[model samples]
Target: AQSVTQLDSHVSVSEGTPVLLRCNYSSSYSPSLFWYVQHPNKGLQLLLKYTSAATLVKGINGFEAEFKKSETSFHLTKPSAHMSDAAEYFCVVNPGTYKYIFGTGTRLKVLA
Candidate 1:
């Protein structure tokens, strides 16, 4: 199985606050990393990805991550957490397989 790690299983924040979702991974070959956001009863939305290109990858919804091979970490960060951001976040790795291996999954709660 591919290697992936989520530093937190849950994150709580107030609206308009900053958000960070930490992840670290290991792979035998080059890894394709993805950050997906899931709202309640909603499918996963691609937030960002790292494809062995640039170390720093920019993503939709003003999110970004830096791929660090030394530390093997790909952390998700947002300047401000919107109420809509209160959902589940998953850190996934593609190990050249059809099925995606997801992290434990993080639940984000936005406080008013």
Candidate 2:
């Protein structure tokens, strides 16, 4: 079984500052991990994904994540925060199946 846990329920960052959203996973084997962001009343948007490729995965809107098998972590990061970046983020794990295990989610608040 694979599962994902978002370390933070909420995160606040000032505009133009760096942003970090931590995520950890539990899996028996190499698992596919993903980061998705959902704005208010909007659907989930793919930020980045790791699927046995490069350890450093880049995604849209200046976001990226590093897949660390040793630590069982795939934390998302951005050089700077933007107001538009404020949203609910989800970490997902795929255990080589159609089903996906999602984290509780982290709500980002970008302060102006």
Candidate 3:
């Protein structure tokens, strides 16, 4: 079985500052992890993914994550934050099954 846990329910950052959102997971085998962002009243958009390839994965808008199998973690980070980045982010895990386990989600609040 595989599951995802978003460590933070909410994260606030000022414009042009760095942003960090933590995530953890558990799986019986190698799992495919992904990040998705949902804007207000909009659909979810794929950010990045890790499927046993490179540990370091880059996404749109300068966001990136590193897969640490030893730590069972895949935390998202960005060098600078933007106002448009404010939204709900989710950590998902697919364990070679048809089911995709999604986290509770972390709402990012970018302040001016």
lDDT of 3 by residue, 4-85 (tens): 9999999999999999999999999899999999999999999999999999999998999999999999999999999999
- Candidate 3 has which clashing residue pairs, if any? none
Q: What tens digits encode model 2's per-residue C-alpha lDDT throughout 1-112?
A: 6788999999999999999999999998779999999999999989999999899999999999999999999999999999999999999999788889999999999999
Comparing 1 and 3 on lDDT, the stronger one: 3
Give a tens-digit lDDT track for model 1, residues 4-107: 88999999989898898999888877789999999989899999988889989999988899998899899998899888778899999997778677899999
Give candidate 2 regions above 4 Å deviation.
Answer: none
Q: After superposition, how far is residue 109 of candidate 1 from its true place, in Å?
A: 0.9
Show the lowest summed lDDT stretch of 10 residues, model 1: 93-102
TM-score of each: 0.92, 0.98, 0.98
Residue pairs clashing in model 1 are none
Q: Tell me how candidate 2 scores on lDDT.
A: 0.95
| Model 2, residue 19: C-alpha shift (Å) | 0.3
Candidate 2 vs candidate 3: which has greater lDDT? 3
In angstroms, the error of model 3 at 64 is: 0.2
Which run of 10 residues does model 2 get worst, by summed lDDT? 92-101
